[model samples]
Target: MKNFILALIVGLLVSACSIQRSAITGDKRAYGYSWEQEKQIGKEADEQIKQHFGVYDNVALQQYVNKIGQEMLAVSHMQREDTPATYKDTEFFFRLLDSPVVNAFALPGGYIYVTRGLLSHLDNEAQLAVVLGHEIGHVAARHASQRAFIQQMSQIALVGGAIAGQHFLGIPGGDLLGIGGMAAQVIFLSYSREDERESDRLGVEYASMQRYKSAEGAQFFVSLERMSAQSGQSIPNWQSTHPDPAERATSIPELAEEWRAIGYEQTIVNTDQYMGMLNNMIYGDNPREGFTRSGTYYHPEMKFQFSYPEGWHVINQRSLVAVVNNDQNAVSIMTLDNESAGAEASVNVFLNQDGITTTGKSGITNRGLQAFQAEATGQTQDGVALKFYLYSIEYDGMIYRFINYTTVDNYGTYGPRFKEITSGFRQLTDSGILNIQPVRLQAVKTTRSGTFRSFLPANLENLVINVTPEDIAIMNQVGLDERIESGTWIKIPR
Candidate 1:
């Protein structure tokens, strides 16, 4: 009875809030957050995203994307002559994230991001314009706000039903209240198919108005289709948040034709300039960051190596490296403590954290490096007890921290494995491993007419990670058997 009453009060309070006008449609609608609140949310989330993905370290590339984004934004509904005064001058921020995942997305406000992986797959500036415009459409249309509003309304009904069931039918509402709060945080990450279709139309419109070859966007979708098929994860349009890539590939050209018929005359595909920008761009995973070989993980740039347990899964990121046991119950993580002056200081910082109880502490030495070892007990946010084996080593004027943890019940089974992995850390000195460099995309001009496959070196796959002739063909938006003319520019991984 109390829960039901509380839910009713919450719903009524939400219903009483003022509605806002959409930036695109200019129609008053109920949104979960005001425009100002949406901006603040995006501002805060943008910081987290920068820290997580690390911005791509290319000022020229970033400025080029921003320049294109600004051009598209000018033609968008948010900046049109008839747009509301409140939205007319809204600032849009475009960022290039240093990730190898082919993805692009927009936040609730005007924050947009594209990965270098996506940039590498693009063929021309017009395609990039369409992509940025698509993300801009999402922001201009307030799709995130609409999705949040719908999510909140659904949560209200769910909460009301759960409370009613508990009060009348004596059914337990297992953590239903907590789910709403968690779901709200990630609501902007995805959108409905209708929202996607609307953005696609708006994308073509904006790019076409800019005199770009908006139909070029269709080739990018074709590459996406090939990628999906190669990854073996193709799904029906009904099960996807966005329309099928093949469908989009066919529709994008038609959308461009519609704009052309109405006097847009979209014809601006700067292929040479776009290809020049991609010259020597990082292609796939950078082994200089960290890479696993055999049972050891090596960091060529940091000049360190560590042995992980055999058969354990290893994940290397910019900030840390994680090794997980097969059953997924235990994990060992290594991170650089840039703020700490010494090994003991790093371990002390960990021990001083709230809710962390140090059970044991001792001095240790590994590979002639000064180190500190400690055992601690802590409870996760979910109240599950964990046993931690912490090790910190000072080497080359830097502190490297290894944090290994498992459930208290499973500590006995995994404690030795954790210790062995951490103890194996040592300076990386092999000349071959230290000199390894990341593969980069190289622009090559064909000297003789031949099929695309014949242009590639036989050992192309050996030089690049997870790359094949077909993959290179897809990157160039060509078929493997497609003929190439002499003096034509093509990208090859080198």
Candidate 2:
């Protein structure tokens, strides 16, 4: 467990500044994480990043990425090492991972990451440069630093509420937690409309300066919006707090117009070459470890896996595990299934819910012991028809919900996914899949005949490659300068 210095400081600052405000609210300005305190906060953020995704390691990829990124930075006003300014000595980094999700982010001291999912969708190098440029702007602008300072402000506000013992801190997500408890969370999520808009402007300006066509970059974001509409959902963390779709759609055109008015020309650099590079790049979902084999589901992380009936699709997220059933006409949502107290109490509490209306109940010991099943149906508060059989089991002192939906079909033919998903609910076991480790990105040097393998370890063969000489020559001139070498490092998803 890493020490959370900002959280600790939040604890300390509240003590000194207990002055109550006219009305309680959670705001970071009340407390302070001065420039002097930034180092500690950065340290904490580093630990958090490591815990979240493990540094995307690919040396060759990092070098190529850093070169392109620094090229963009050359035109940025952020301080360089010699000028004696705020961002001097800042080192930028990149993580290469095959996540299939379009996401990229920057940490306080120039740490940046781009998921392979987004990389695959990009139409060209200029688009890629724009994405990197926008993230670089975040680092240069010190927006995160500003947010951290806001956290301090929130802390002070929290303190005022504690002293007065009042509810509602007048801040976002303000509740009876006295603000002190949820202050950091609030600030982290306080992505005001202004922040996103600013990022868009910065991205466009940076791309324009790099001589990379800014409109091509804008087109990628537009594509993402189209994808979201086709899927009937927006991205998670990437979009949850982003400006509304209409607001977001308007931003890029405005930036493009600004660039055009200033005489910036549009350019497309090697769109086909870019697409060719992704020909064999693992498409859709990764199937090496746990994936939907036919219609079954498997996960190595939880150590237990199960299979569903035929034809049902699965949507796996970081937090929730869900599967839809076609034949049974239902969907199942798998969660931690945690209760306020503990596992045993949770089962009892669920069973005792009002209007449960149990039909046939029985006890079963599928994996081990202490498990029960009940059939019940009721209308959820949203007026959606609900029907299912819930099975509660205690595994590792945790209660798990294995629900089978057979009653309501809100999503219609597609709704069967819910039932197929819940039906596949079962315990995981130690199997061949559990033995495989996820691959990481590693950068390597390529010879005149250099291949991707020289950089990848034996264990990462599932993700290694052999680079071609012609490919190296092209990238050298157009993208990350391809200095031919007998041995060098490049990035690859592990």
Candidate 3:
């Protein structure tokens, strides 16, 4: 198959380059997809990207992501001026965030953010290209704008807007007003099965054209499915945006068949290199951005800390953090709202994201507090179901507690974990936590080290380097024919 595709595509390479030359394409794709539409949609969706996940800042990581992104654009059908690529005019930005959410998101202006969690999961550059291209397809197809346009087209936006303005005065501009605790409920309200499937197909084709085997790219999703089942958590972001994994699983193999018939090969999964990039890339969460430690939650900037039950898992995403107990029953998170005068204003800002009512003398308390709970009566779009409890409690001018979610239809596999985490929420004591700075690898020379093994103690502690067979190879290049040196600056493993 590889030999056949290699020979056959020799002639059609240029033809594939002009895939966007025609205004009308095929039923094989979502009709009326144009460059202009993609840009318009990207404009709106970009706002959502900012509102949801802010830009991730890291220089070396960003440069590499853009280089790959540019290569993808050179091979894709997104450059027609009238049908200008979604980010043609914009500078493409890519960076790794210090997050464990395992996500990759694209903003309107070619702003792309990939989490270290997701980076740790990918195998190679080709696989990364496929995922990045799929996101580009979303921008190209105007999915985000289409969804928002459709939302406005329907009465949902109006009713949602009125509800948003009336109760949640602390609502910010643009969409996603109450996004934190309402993810599971509001997700399916966006795209359809057909739209996502089309994106998948096109994504593969784009990858194929770029000479990055789409087959391996498809495997990332497969690996994710297995990882999610093993972790018993909801299928992370790989399949989160696009649901129906079992069916999608079948589709990828089918597409592989299509590419096989037309000549597509698979890329190798380089787990070693992948993990190396993740090493010291900042694990779990950045404590600086408000995460809890020990039995207490602290926000040094927000100037407060909350206590939690022991043995609970804590999650700290930007804007909020929550602790769940072992029973899959309760959770406590945090938020900040400065709109309502005094406590009422803060509480109003916190509840505004979900259209919750913040009226009539809302007071601050500890145990019994203001919160919202959502029950998933049936299955979610991805078929791995969940239920969620969301709310905010405050102390000393700071408001905290968003939601703790659990799996329901899926036999509560992730549910028990969720409960244990949420149940840990409590008030803070006067005790403070000591800070420790994490050591990261710099592109500096080997300041002091006898050997790779000696530098890495038995316990490893803050040591991030992994003497992989490849690193050993690079080490050989040191001070010989090239500038590679003892500490000639390379990324260390997480």
TM-scores of the models, in the given order? 0.88, 0.51, 0.54
Off by over 4 Å in 1: 1-18, 156-188, 234-239, 381-383
TM-score quality measure for candidate 1: 0.88
Task: List per-prediction Cα lDDT, in the order shown.
Answer: 0.82, 0.53, 0.49
Output the worst ten-in-a-row residue range by lDDT, candidate 1. Answer: 167-176
Steric clash count of candidate 1: 0
Best-fitting candidate, scored by lDDT: 1
Over 1-494, each residue of candidate 2 has an lDDT whose tens digit, in order, gives 24698777766765533221111121233323333233444545555445333433445544655666777667654543343343455555555554555677765556666766676556576777777877777655556555544655666342223211222112221222112232333224335457667777777777787677766665566656655665578764457556765565567767867887888775645455454444345433454435655556677666556676566556564434555544434556555665535434444555578856656666666545466666566655556556656666666666666655544444444334443444345666556666645433233344543333333345433432333332222222212232335543233444
User: Which RMSD does model 2 reach against the true structure?
Assistant: 12.9
- Stretches > 4 Å off in candidate 2: 1-51, 54-63, 79-84, 151-188, 245-250, 260-268, 292-494
Which candidate tops TM-score? 1
Candidate 3 segments exceeding 4 Å error: 1-48, 80-97, 105-113, 144-189, 238-279, 293-295, 300-303, 308-315, 322-333, 337-432, 437-494
- The residue pairs that clash in candidate 1, if any, are none
Residue 405 of candidate 3: its Cα lDDT? 45
